[model samples]
Every structure is written in C-alpha cells, then in structure tokens.
Target: MAAMKKKSVKKKSVNKKTASKSPCKQKLSVSISHDHKLGHDPLAWLSGEEIQSLSKINDTVDPMTFKETKIENEKIHVPGIEAEKNIDQPVALEEMTKDIDDVKASETGSLPGDEDKTQRTNEDDDMLILPEIFGIAQAEDMHGELSSLLAVSGDIEIDASTIETLDASALQLLIAFIKECKSSGRNVIWKKSSAKIDSAASLLNIGTLLEL
Candidate 1:
C-alpha cells in the first residue's frame, strides 16, 4: 500500500509540472511590414542618376551677378514751321458736314417730287393732278405732293383722270393718304378716276376703304 501511494503522488507532480511548462512554451507571434514586395526595399528601385536628381532638388543656389550697361540716346531735331507746310491740313468740320450733305442729296435727290411739284399761287386751282403712270415709281412723288397739299390747309381735289397704270402699292399709298386726309378733317375730292384706277381699286378690294 505504501509503494502504491508514493507512485500516485509522483504522477500528480508530473502532471502539474507539464501544465506549467506548456503555458511557458507557447509560440510568440512576430509582426513584419508587407507594404513592399518580399525581399525588395522601395528605396533600392532608384538609380544613381535619380538619387543625384533628388539630392540636387534641395541644393543651395549660387550668388547672381549683374552688369551695368550705359545706353547713349540720340537726340532728334524737328523742323518747326517748315514741317507744318509739308503736312496736309485737316479738313474743317463745316467742310466735312457740307460734303456729307452733298452726298445725301445726290443719293436720295431733293425731297420726293420737289422737281416736278406744281407750283401754284392762291389764285390757281386747288387740285393736285396725278401723273399718267401711277405705280411704285410714282408713289414717292404722289406722297410728297399729297403731303404738300396737306400743309396748305384746305379742301383739295385729286385729278385721277390719267392714271395709265395703277399698281397695288400705289393704290395702298392713295388709300393711306385719303385716310390721313379724313383724320385731319380735310376734304378730299376725286376728280373722276381712270378705268385703270377703278380696276386696281376693285382688285385690291380696298374701294370701300378708299371711299371710292
């Protein structure tokens, strides 16, 4: 019995020693940076020229030298009154304005029918005779003539007896003129229109508007 008890105590001590040794013998974990490839360092990729360029990026600058240069300026001599005679004189504003007015007169001619406007005194008949050909070519003259009549401030008669060719534009101008006459409270008398004028007025369907 004594030998069996001593054997059991030795077995328990062996188990306790084994447990303590197992805790102390546990493997210790080590950490390593894996940012780069296995055996290559990032700085090892740079060549000697590249390292030299990087080193030069922070190198000190050399002292600068500046040389002074003296420039000789040539003096210019200008002629006084003699130079003024050689230069062309500028045109006066009044002359330039006159030239512009002359151009305008040449382009558009004297206002409408002033060239052919019948000059009549108070004793003459108060009638404006239409030209033989009443078309776009004559509308401007007719307008000017009618406007002049309006300025006269009196009841007027329009002689339409000789309108050989009456166009739509001319008819429109006559209709507008008649309207203007009526609005100004002025009387307008039509001295017997030609057959062309009557046909043109009917074709445009403005006979009623013109009070024809």
Candidate 2:
C-alpha cells in the first residue's frame, strides 16, 4: 500500500512537470493614435514663416486654375513655335526672285503680263465699261475680253467708275492688260476711276503697276 501511494505521488509530480513544459497560447493587440494634441503638430519641424508661405502657396494655387493656365500657355506657345517652324523655310530666295523680276520688268518697260504684246491692229479706239463686282469669279471672262482688246489699235478707254467690289484677282487682270497695252505702245485711258480700285491697288502695293 505504501509503494502504491509512492507511485501515485510520482505520477502527480510528472503530471505537474509536463503541464509546466507545455507551450502557452497568447493574443496580441495593436493601437494607432490619430489625435493632433497641442504641442504635437506634424509640421512642428517647419518654421512659422515657412508654414505661412506654404499656406499662401496652397491657397493661391488652385488645381483647376493651374491646369487652365497651363493649357492657355501651351495654346499661346504652340502658334509661336509653329510660326518659327514655318519661318525656317527658304522664303528669302522666293522673295529675292520676285524682287528681281519686278526690277527687271520695271527697267525694261515690258512688265509681266498674261501674253506677249505681239498682235497689233489698226482699228479705231475702243471704250470698255467695267462690271460692278469684278473679282476672282469674273477673272476668266475678264482675261478673255482683255486679251481680245489687246489687238485693238489706238488708245483704249476703260471706265472704272462702275466697279464696286474689286479684289486682288481683278486687279491682277487689269495690271496684265495695262502692261500689255504699254508694251505694245497702245495708250490706255481711265475715263473714270472708282474708290474701290484705287484702295485695292494701294493696299496691294500695285498702284504703280496698275498706273492708278
């Protein structure tokens, strides 16, 4: 019986040791603080003036307005960039050639026209009444009439008082006709002049060319 009691005590002691050696399970918890208490400012490292400047910048720079301003600046800059690109072409050569042609035409007294003034006639002097609206639309008909008239003899009378809407194309045709007349030694008299013709000629810097 004593031996059985000692064995029961030993079993109890082993049970206590096994219980102490077993792993323990525990739960952990984490907490986050979001309160901005006094003397705990996130921007505490920044100076007062720096903070004020930053606030001013934030107030002045609106996201939408800044985006709009950037767009407007791009709009303005794009045209200038395109203009610069266009100006980089060989325009100087074309302009120089045109100037040389004009100078030669002026010096020779045989200005550039549609046709060479070779056809001559001994018919009586003619009078032509210009149409009211002389523009690009009427250029073809006017050119035909002027070419036919170039063959007429004596002084040609041109009544320009009826012209109302005269454009560059009409002015060009008239210039060609006048140059043809001058080269052929035929006189061209402007019986009546219109303000539109004079203004257009002056605007195009072809007043001398048209003998306005």
Candidate 3:
C-alpha cells in the first residue's frame, strides 16, 4: 500500500507539470481594436497588385487563424509604442494609378456607359452612370448600400425614394449588378446613405447617357 501511494503521488505531479508546460501557453498580452468591414467585394476596393499581394499574404497567414479570430479581433498590438504606426501601404500608389487611368480615359473620351464583358446588364451595351465625386471616399456609400441590399430584401428601386421599395429580389439583383460591374473594371458611384441617390438617378442625363 505504501509503494502504491508513492507511485500515485508521482503520477499526479508529472501530470501537473505536463499541463503547465502546454504548447498553448502564452506569456505576453497585446491587442488592437478594429471596426472591421467583412464580406467586402475585395475586387472593387483592392487593386490588381494589392489583391495579388493580399492573396500571397492569405496563403502565408494560416487559414486557421482567420477562422479562429474575427477580422476585428485579428489586429495585432506591438509592445513599446514610442510612435503610432499607420497603414503599411501608402494611399499614393492606388491614387496615382487611378489618376493615370482617368487621364487616359479623358484622352480617349471614355463615356460612363462603356461596356465590358463581365457587366450584368441583359443588354450588351448597358453603361454605368459615373458621378462627380471621385476617389475611395465615395466607395463607402456605394459598398454599404450594396452590402445592405445583399443582406435582405426590401423595395429595391433606383428611384428618388427607392429604399422603401426594396425587397429581397431587388437587393439580390442590385448586389449582382455591383459585383458584375466590379469584376468588369467598370467605374462606380457609391452614393451617400442620405444623399438621395434616387433623386440623382432622376437628375442624371439618361438621354445623353444612352448610346444610340
């Protein structure tokens, strides 16, 4: 009985040591808060290079990490914050590329209604109406409505009072249109939430936009 008790005590100590030495042991603590945007149409927001870079990063960033952590929770906080670090990639490159494209488009007088193969219109020649405000700032409004429409059905009208008319079908169609346009490299105007896009749609020179 004495020998058995000694062996039992030894086994308990070994188990405790093994538990304490678990590979999952973490010592340091740091975190960051992010108001994450999920289900983003990455193609719309990311340049070809950025997309490629992200894909490489994704390949390297263990897929399990993404599954385990929500996008907002994945933000890393480095210790010893002597200075605040900004986004790694500068906005300049994307802005420059967009400017160059706009210049080239101007030189060629590219109309808003330009057709690309991936566009969602049933007709081959359907064109998007380009708005005056340029840059990524406009994209927020555009993607928000686009995302909302995709989420549920409501009265989906391109009218001045359209949101009230949106239904599930309309939202689905709108999402499809946005995706198609994005995939086709078509220019888009993300309207502001309170911007009365339906009114703008009415104001748009539809006659002039239509290609005869």
Index of the highest-lDDT prediction? 2
lDDT of 1 by residue, 13-57 (tens): 123455468945433322222221132222432442322232222
Model 3 worst lDDT run, 10 consecutive residues: 1-10
**lDDT per residue (tens digit) for residues 22-93 in model 2:** 623211111111121121233533453332232332122222223321111222224655564333232344
RMSD of every prediction: 44.6, 39.9, 22.0
Candidate 2 residue-wise lDDT at 114? 10
Residue ranges of candidate 2 with Cα displaced over 4 Å: 1-125
lDDT, residue 192, model 2:
91
- Ranking of all predicted structures according to lDDT, beginning with the best and ending with the worst: 2, 1, 3
Q: State model 2's lDDT.
A: 0.55
Model 3: per-residue lDDT, tens digit, 1-212?
Answer: 01111111111111335446872542222111112212223453234333323233212222223342212323333546623644344245444555544553343342232232122222312223333442254454444334433322222333222233322333333445555444544434433232333433345532222110
Model 3, residue 105: C-alpha shift (Å) = 31
- Model 3: how far residue 173 lies from native, Å: 0.3
